[model samples]
Target chain A: EFDQIHNYFSLNPLYRASEMRKDTAGLQAAKNNMSTKFVLFSDQKPFLLRSEEPSRKYKFAVFNINQLGTELLERGTVIFLGLETWDPDSNAWFAVDIKEELSDIGPKFFPEGKYATPFPVTMQMEPTQAGIFAEAHSVLCWLDKYKFCSTCGSATKIAEGGYKRVCQNWECSSNKGVQNTCYPRVDPSLIMLVVSPDKKDCLLGRQKRFPPKMYSCLAGFMEPGECLEDTCRREVEEESGIKVGRVDYHSSQPWPFPAVLMLGCIAYARTSALKVDTSELEEARWFSRAEVAQMLAGQHPHGLYVPPGEAIAHQLIKSWVASSFSNL
Target chain B: EFDQIHNYFSLNPLYRASEMRKDTAGLQAAKNNMSTKFVLFSDQKPFLLRSEEPSRKYKFAVFNINQLGTELLERGTVIFLGLETWDPDSNAWFAVDIKEELSDIGPKFFPEGKYATPFPVTMQMEPTQAGIFAEAHSVLCWLDKYKFCSTCGSATKIAEGGYKRVCQNWECSSNKGVQNTCYPRVDPSLIMLVVSPDKKDCLLGRQKRFPPKMYSCLAGFMEPGECLEDTCRREVEEESGIKVGRVDYHSSQPWPFPAVLMLGCIAYARTSALKVDTSELEEARWFSRAEVAQMLAGQHPHGLYVPPGEAIAHQLIKSWVASSFSNL
Candidate 1:
C-alpha cells in the first residue's frame, strides 16, 4: 500500500483558492488588513531575520505593508499568494520583488544594521515563509523572464493585480483569447523510485552538481502530449536503461528552484539491466532496503546518504524503508 | 482495481526522448531523413488534409520538410518533437508555427484550392495525428506567447533547437542556471470522479460553457505548494461543497488545449451535500450508477452525455461504470 507522508515544500495550509478572479479587490483588502504581512525577494532570495528563539535560529523577515513606504511599492511587482488560515485571523501575505529597484536605489529601505538580511530561499525558512516564498519567487521569475509579448515582441503590462501580463500592443494576436498573453506558467516533472522485480532493492542516481555521496530518485519534466506515468517510465529507461512496469503514484512536492511540480512515484521494474547514461547521471545503482534505511537514519557505514528531509527524495526513501521493514 | 486503460491522448507511441540534447544536429539529420514529416499549426489550430481511405475521413496535413520553401522556414518557429518509434521507419515529426507569417505571406506555399484546410484542433483528427497535433499546437502556442523576455522586456531568441527561449540581453540573471528561459511548460490539473460512500452514485458538475445537460468530473489546476490529492479534494469542496476522503490517481492525459497535463483520479466522498459555486459551475449533483452507465453508452433518457472517448472525463466515467456494475 502507498503511504502519504509529509514532503518538504508540499505542506502549506496558508494557500487558498486557484483562480482569484477578484485579485484586484483581494490585493487592496489584503494591503489594508491589520494583520497583513509583506515578504520581500531580491535576485530570487528571500530576506531573513535572526530569531531570538534558540530552537530555531532563523525567521522570515516579514514586514507590515505600510513599513516599506510608497517608493518601494510603486517600483516592484506585487503578488498576492493567499490568506494564512493557520492563524485564526486568516491574514493575507504578499511577496514583493525589488531586484531591479535594489540596484538603482541601493537598499535604501533595507538600510545597514537592519533587523533583516537577504538570504537564499533554499536555506530553511519557517514552513509558511517557505511556501510563500516559493509562490512569490515563481511569479517573480516568470514576470522577469516574460516582459515582452510573444505574438508581436511588444512590451507587456501587469494585469489582474499581478496575476497576469497583457501585451501593450492592441493589435497583438496574443490578445485574441480569454487566455491571451498573460498566463502564468508552472512546469510539471515526474520523480520516481524504481524497484527491482523482486522488490528487494530500489534504484537511485546522483548528478555531478549534487553534494558528495547524495543519491536521489530520477526526475524529468513532463513533456507536451504525454501523461505523467509515461514521463516517469521514459525517464527511468533513459537515465538507467531500466524498463519500469506497474507504476504507482506516491506523492507530489512543489520544488521552487524556479518552480516545478514534482510528482513522486514507485515503479516495479520489468528489466534489471543497469546501463547508466552518463549524459543524464554520474552514477546509478540498486540499493537494498536495509541500506536505504541506514542512509535515512544517518547510520550508513560507507558515508553515503540521501537528500535532507526538505526534499521529496528523502520522503520517498523514508517511506520505502518504513513499508519494507515495519513488520520486523 | 484500477485497470490501466489506453487513454487517447496518452497513447502516442511516437514520442521518443524527453530532453533532446543534440536537438540542433538531430533536427538537421531528421530533415535530411527520407522519413521526415512536418505538422503545421496556425493560431493553435491544426491544418487537416482529406484521407483517401473511405474508413477514415480526415488526416493530418503532413508536409515533407524539404517541400516547404526557405521563406516559411525563415519566418516561423520549428519545434523538433521526438521520433515516431511506433513506425518501423522511425519518422521524425516537427510542429511548425506559421501564425505571424501566414497572413502577410498569404499561404504562399500552402497553395489555394489545395487538399488541406485549417481546423480547430478540438475536432477529431486521426488518433496518432491528433496526438501529434496536440503536441505541435502546444509548442507553437508557447512560442507565440513567449517571444519576449519577462525579466527585462527584451526580445528573446529560440535556443536549444527550438525547445527554449533565451533572452538576448547577455547579462540577464535568468541565464545563470543550466536551464534558463527555454523550458517548455505543462500546467498540472486534477480531475476526479467523486463516488458516494455506498458506491450507489457519483458526483458530476458542469461549467457554463459545457453543452446543455453535459456534466463531467470536477477539475482545477494544482496550485503552488500543493500535492495532487489535496488539489483534487480542494477543487471538489470548492465547486460542489462536497468533502472527499480517499483519493486515488486513475490515469493522466495530455490536454493540449494550449498545454495542460490532466491527472485523472477517483475520490471516495465523506459528505453527500452538494452546494454548487455559481462562479465555478452551473450545477452539480449525484447520479445513480445506472444513469452514468447509460450516459457513457449514449443511452441516457434525458439526452445527457459525457464527453467523447478522447477526453479523460469519458475515461473516468467508463472506468467507474466497468468497476461498479460490470458483474451485474
Candidate 2:
C-alpha cells in the first residue's frame, strides 16, 4: 500500500532531495510553534432518557467546524474523525479553515456540513508530515476513547507519551504497569471499483449522507479472516447486487479519518445489473468511463461529480476513467 | 527506503507474477493441502516474554502443530508473537518469534509446557492472506499493553475488528480509538555518522548491547517537534558530546523487529574532541575509512564488525566508509 510514495515511515534519510529538505524544515517549524493548536476530535456524550427504562447512549462526535476552531488557521489547525454531525436545522456548523489555497475545499466539501473530517490537514506540514500526523491522530483518537480495561472492566490510566493505558482496578489485576486488554488498532479495509467486461462502464454507489447526485466506488470494512478481494466482491454484491468475478489490483490510501487503511482494488463484473439496497445505500448504478472523466473534470453535462482526491474511492474511480495507476 | 528497493507493495497487482485469472480453479489450485496455506504477517513481533508476568494472565493463541495447527502444515502453521528469553529471571526480557524461514522454526519458538487454547478460527483469506492478519497481531499486542485512555484517565473497550477502543466513562467523554502503541511500538528514529572537514574518520559508538571493541554509527530516537536534521545533530551531540552540523539525509528502512523506522543521515562534526557517557555506552571512538572497510569486508584484524543487513546502522556506517567523499 505504501509502495509508490516515499512515506515518512519508509523514506531513507540518505536519499533526500532539496525539496524534501525544505519540507522537513517546514514541518518542524509548525511542530515547534508551541502556540494553540486546533485539534478536531469527536465528543460523544451519553444522556439518560426519561421515557426509556435504561439510558440509550448515542454514539457520535462533532464534525462541525465553527468560527472559533476555524479561526485558528493563523494559530494552527488539524482535522480527524469525530462523532458529532452538524444539525442542519441550526446554523452552528462552520467550514474548516485549510489556510488559503484550499478554498475550493469549502465549496466542493462541507457546502452544508462535512460528513467526516477532511484529509490532508494543514498548518505548515512537510510533504510526509501530514501522513505521519494522521497516523498518530488515529492512534491518539483510539487511546482517547478506550480508557478502561475491557476484561475486568476497570478504570485505566495513561502512560508513555499517551501511548499506553493501564487499569486502575487493583482487584482486577488485568493490567500491569504498561500493558492492558483494550486494544489499539488500525482497520484494514478494501475499497474497489467494479469494472465492466467491455471496460467501458464502472461501478459507483450513493449513500443517504452523500451530497445529492454524488456517487463513489463500493467500499466496506474488512471482516476478520476474509480476503481483501473477497471483501471487495462481497461489498460490491451486497451494495450494488453485482457479482464480481476477477478482481484486479489497484492502489491503497491511509484514510485515518478514523483509523482505516483503504485497500483499493478493481474487480470485473460478471453481469451488469443494478440492485440498490435503500436501507444501506440510496442507489447503485454503473457509469461509463467517459461519464466519470467528465465528472472528474467537472465538465459533466449532467452536472454530476465524484468525491475529491483526498479519498481512495475518488482516486479509484479516477484511475479507471484515466486508465492510469496511482502509487499510494 | 522504498526508493532504493520497491518490493511487493510497489509491484501493485502483478504480485510475483500471480495474475487474477477469471477462474475459481486458480483459487483452488492456489490452496495447498499441507504448507500451501499459512498465516502471514508484516509487523515483526519480538515475543521476548511469553507466558510471563502481567502478560501471562492474558490469553495467547498458539497452535500445537499437531493435527490442528502444525499438522496442517500442508496448510502451514499460524506463526505469531510470544515472548522468548534465555533467562527466566525478571531482570531481563525480550520479545521473541520465528521470522526466519518457516522450514526452520525450532523448539526455541514453541517451547514445551506452554499449552494454549485453539479457537479453531476458520475462514477463507484472499490476495495476500497474511497482510490483515499481521495487522491484527500488531494491533492486538498494542491493545494488550495500552489499558487506559492516555488523553483522559478512563477505561476503554475494543471495537472495529479490534481496530479501535472507545472510552466508557461518560464523565470523561473521550472517543479516541485505534492506537499503534504495543510491546513493540515502532519508534521512528534517526542516526548518523558525523564527519569532519579533515575527512579522516567519522564518529561511531559502542553501546552496552554491542560486543567488546565493536563500534558503529552514533544514532538516536527522533523527538517530537524536531526534523531529521535536528535529530541527527541532537543524537550526535548527546552520545559523543560532539557538536555536529551540515546534516544530509541518506536512506531509510523498516526495522520492524519491534517497530522502528531507522533514518540514516550524514553530518559534519563541529568538534573533534570526544566525550562519552559510559553509563549508556561502553565507548565512543572514530575509526578511519581503512579500518571500517576491513570491518565491512569481515577482515578486520580485531574481528570487529558492524550491525547486520536488516539494520540501517550497518548501511550508514558502510556507506560512509566506502563513499568517495570519505576523505572530504
RMSD value for candidate 1: 4.4
Per-residue C-alpha lDDT of model 1 across residues A116-179, encoded as one tens digit per residue:
3323334466665566666776777777766776667788888765667888888877787666
Query: TM-score, each model?
Result: 0.86, 0.41
Local distance difference test, each candidate: 0.73, 0.48
- Candidate 1 residue spans exceeding 4 A from truth: A1-4, A15-26, A50-57, A69-71, A86-89, A99-123, A324-328, B1-3, B15-23, B42-44, B50-57, B65-76, B86-90, B97-123, B197-199, B324-328
B6-25, model 1: which lDDT tens digit per residue? 56666665656545635577
Could you tell me the TM-score of chain A in candidate 2?
A: 0.61
Query: Of the candidates shown, which would achieve the greatest lDDT relative to the real structure?
Result: 1
